[model samples]
Target: MIRLKSPSEIATMREAGRVVARTLAAVAEAARAGVSLSELDELAADLISAAGADPSFLGYRPTWASTRYPGVLCLSVNDAIVHGIPDGRVLRDGDLLSIDCGAYVEGFHADAAITVGVGDLDDRARHLSETTRLALEEGIAAVAVGGRLSDISHAVETVARGAGYGVPPNMGGHGIGTKMHEDPHLANTGRPGRGVRLREGMVLAIEPMLIESGRDRARTARDGWTVLTGDGSRAAHWEHSVAVTGDGPVILTLP
Candidate 1:
């Protein structure tokens, strides 16, 4: 069922979103060559705890996964697309790292992700990241009173595919409130004016994941969590949790 959040619940989620934003900022600032992904995970856990929130990704076991996620952050590097587990692997210069994080506070939840270059990046890397970010912006813009969910998906697809990028078909965004994942799965590509109708109080995590080679599929990692490009292409991901209001869309996960 689609859970519509009340104003008070949205406020609580905003607080959780603040913690998530701060955590991502801190992780990005610390993301450099030689730093292990595990270190970033630890940092996220500490920051979330300091903010009086819990890491929503920790111990989360989706039915599709083989086991519970063991890290506070999903660290996808280079060709890895999403659900990348944090480990002892050290980052390197020119690597693209995608970080997905979630925070739970007072029974509400906020989830977001960002992809960044570790150091000097080539034109393709920068282009992929920037395009994915812009795609996310487009998706978020589609959220408003009386809008359709597929409109957001179509908007995201237009931006990424227009840039000659590819989007993983099965991997996209979701509704979020009191849970890390919720109803109304937002696809990366879809027909506009189809699917659920947008209404006041509906909160969603709209993310755009883009690939360099225009490949539309991904291969799961041996760890059962990380998902990488099927064609070995570099990918980028960006997301934000937003709420549809009577007037317009209110972004709750802004830093």
Candidate 2:
């Protein structure tokens, strides 16, 4: 069931979102060539704990996963898409890194992700990251009271498709509240006037995962967590937890 958050509840989520925002910022700053992905996970874990917020992704086992997620951050590199486990692999120059993190504070949860270039990134990698960010912004702008949920999806699709990129129809965003995932799955492509009606107090995580090949298929890694592009092309992901209010859509994860 879709549940609308109360004002007090939204405030609590904002606190959680800030923790996530700060953690993402710290992780991004620490991300560079020669740094192991595991080190980034450790840094995120410590930051989340120090802020009095719990790491939402740690030990999280979704219905499709064979085991619990073992890292605080989902660090996807290069062709690796979302859910990449932090390991001993060292980042290289020009590597495209996508870091996803979640935080729980006062029983509410917030989730977000960002894709960045490690060092001197190539032109294609930089363009993919920029397009994903703009797709996320376009999705957010489609969220409004009384609008259909698919409007957001359609907006995202317009941006990605126009750029000759591909967005997996299955993997997108979701409603976020007490739990990291909730109702109303937000696809990256859909009919604008279709799907659930948006209402005040509804919070959604509108993330767009884009593949450079214009093909949406991906493969699951042996770890049962990391997902990579089927054509071995690079991918980018960007997200924000937003709340629909009478005034407008408020991005809770902004620092």
Alpha-carbon runs more than 4 Å astray in model 1: none
RMSD of each: 0.7, 0.7
Choose the strongest candidate by lDDT: 2
lDDT computed for candidate 1: 0.92
In candidate 1, position 80 carries an lDDT of: 92
Cα error, residue 141 of model 1, in Å, equals: 0.8
Q: Which lDDT value does model 1 have at 101?
A: 92
In the range 54-141, model 2's lDDT, one tens digit per residue, is 9999999988988999999999998998999999999999999999999999889999999999989999999999999999999999
For all candidates in order, the CA lDDT equals 0.92, 0.94
Question: Residue by residue across 59-115, what tens digits does model 1's lDDT show?
Answer: 999888879999999999999999898999999999999999999999899999999
